[model samples]
Target: MFEYQNNNYENRNQMYDYYQMPETGGPACNRPSGPKKTGKAGKLVKKIGAITLSAALFGSVAAGSFQAVNTLIGPTETSDNTAATENTSASLLKAAAIPGAASEKGSLDVSDIAETVMPSIVSITNKSVQEIQNYFSMFGYGGQTIPQETESRGSGIIIGKNDTELLIVTNNHVIENADTLSAGFIDNQVYEANVKGTDPANDLAVIAVPLESISADTMSQIAVASIGDSDSLKVGEQVVAIGNALGYGQSVTTGIVSATNRTMGSNTQVVNTSADGSALPTYIQTDAAINPGNSGGALVNMKGEVIGINSAKMASTEVEGMGYAIPMSRVSDIIETLMNETTRTKVSADQKSSIGISGLTVNESVNSIYGIPSGVYVASVTPGSGADKAGIKKGYVITGFDGKTITQIQELTELLQYYPAGETVEITVKIPATGGTYTEKTLSVTLGAAENSNNTQTESGQQEDKNNSIY
Candidate 1:
């Protein structure tokens, strides 16, 4: 579970609840709030203040720095350039001065590591239209949803380059609901971005920028980040964080490995838990400052290799320096899935169906302890969808659907892939009882048409409408 820190924590909670509302209490939409097992694993993650830079490294700058020299004369055009050039020779010289510099060493120059990783890092700005409802408007019956354009800032790492596009990986939360995305380079160049793919379960997303939008000179200077083995990380090892700290350009923070394989709990709103009850995404805990806008930044080791992606941090009056990141090892496959371009394509009306439900696979341990079988737990049912019309109730665990053995929400998603919109399918569910007994029931459900084109499974079994027209 990711911890969000803020003073307006209660207001954020209210906003989160409001996000699940359908414009007119339509039957097709499932409210975000639903009855479920509640457990407090850690403090609630809330708002991170503005201007705070959250990175792993505490010492100085990204890549290298150039000293600006002024000639005693007033500012005027001259044959000599005032700004100095990068000193590659100094890196060599510094490396040479260090003991065993020619071979693998425990530490490398922090500035050099930042300099090397900085070009690969870019700041991202997300602009989305947030439509809020004014229930108190004219006679109360004339309430309407008001659309407001909002802007958010975060950081991303250039991971791959194709002939036509440059791809960067970042937290899904960074670009969620974004109507327009822009990527900014250290040179102050910005490029319009397109959503390549996203997996909110892990809070990961892949955004692509047109290579043609970048200048030839700047493109030549940009480098793809070198990915490292997060499994190889050891506690107490030094690491650095670089990101658009607190929405103000990219900044760096330094710290050591405070802990590893840490589990704050599962964020059911985003993270997908394992069906087998193993392998919850563990975090690399550090003491670095993880402020606002650091959500999608990189956490690199001293060797100038990115081992983790900065995700969340613990912020409170009683807490200090408890930052967290997702291990890079666990991110590779999800990123590759999002990078494939076609994974997030718009769905044709005949290609997909929506059941009007929002649910997720339950935690294995919780299910077992509660005497409930491990399966997809329905959080809420859409008012008049196939599931609701079939008398399917929330809190029921789905064991099978259309003859497919469904033990997890992911399986249910795969099963739905074989069906088309406006198709009727049989659903099998197991109802729980007070005495640890379950009754199996079969129901016929006619799936509804998914809204718009970008119809994809968001959570395990949840199909979130991408079209913002309905607010």
Candidate 2:
């Protein structure tokens, strides 16, 4: 039950850590079959029991549950017979030692790792409870309208210092649409939190909470986790995962570095266009078991340092061990910005200009062979829109925006975030079909306010001033 507000800060510190083996004993034994021999005497009896026992023992060994057996047999007349029996006895002994051999090997202490990393893992709950409204019907019948309240829960990583204030890193969706935000520490201390900054296009968010109530002694116990270079991580390296699994408190899981430089589709949107959707650059994929509440948790290396923030788990009936995390290399810049800035500020919607376009960058082949420019190309134009009204032609290739050269779709999206809607600016575009013309266009068209698919203003958009800004 952490309580948080917009203001108040101090220093605090915190610290905190799946494969299936085949069944060892089952009906999967493969053994040779043979008939039992009968004695020559009239009263001779067949010995099928000995063959059955031997088959069962062989099956147990193959299934990984071998047991040692000592048997006394009559000495054979030939020396070769004795040698064969000795070899068979030695083989049985080795088979029976399989389980013990495994037991002798030591495994990593996951609990110790969990204890070291648990302080940095936080459980986040985002709630959007709406106020109820009541209305009377025309027929004098009373009715109640219960506004729906939405809440989401996820995990976060502690990246900020503990002495002056506590800062957390999590996915933007964890706090997106949340009217109330709170975080619970592994020590059972809950604190109200505030959104410091968020980049939905990257699916990353920075949050902060006051450390006023944190005890002085326990504060020193807080340890700042070291950030490792994700670039250095290699495939097949051992890694660990720590998070609030399924909202059931702090949990730790381990696996190897399943892969690196994995690409994931952007859960965040840009300009309401899937064409312009931005994804996190170079994800770190792991086989660690990450669940619903594990989003925003830490994917740590063997040194117990964080390399990535666990974000998503693959959903499939056939796949049971795939999870994805945002690489820390890409998140360091965003986290640093949030720490330096107190409030999460953005260019007001009305004051923003320049619609961002994505996915039109020319490939190397197109640039080298076909002589196509390698920059973001405008796909289409909105009717009566700012760019359209300003004579900025559709299908024009944008070379630069606001003095920044654009190479990828992310570059355009990032630049647009710096300015608010309704703010007009000049743009440089290369018109390929216009006789190889490169034109500079100055457009003063007022930017239009953003609306969701439901035709309602976005939560962030609602904060804009419609009168002075765009309509």
Q: Give a tens-digit lDDT track for model 2, residues 218-241.
A: 456555566777888888777788
Identify the candidate with maximal lDDT.
1
lDDT of 1 by residue, 1-471 (tens): 222221212211111111121124445324357565344521221112111223212112321121122232225323222321123334334333332332222357567677788888999999977777766675577668898889999989999977788999998778776667899987878888877876655677898998888898788778888888899888878788999987899898888889999876544322212212444567889887778888888998866788998888774567778888889997798787678753232334366776666676766677767767767777666665677788877778887776444666755664454467777877888887767788999888888765521232342244433432110
The lDDT per prediction is 0.69, 0.62
**TM-score of model number 1:** 0.56
As for model 1, its CA RMSD to the true structure in angstroms is 32.1
What's the number of clashes in each of the models? Answer: 17, 29
Best by TM-score: 1
Q: After superposition, how far is residue 464 of candidate 2 from its true place, in Å?
A: 20
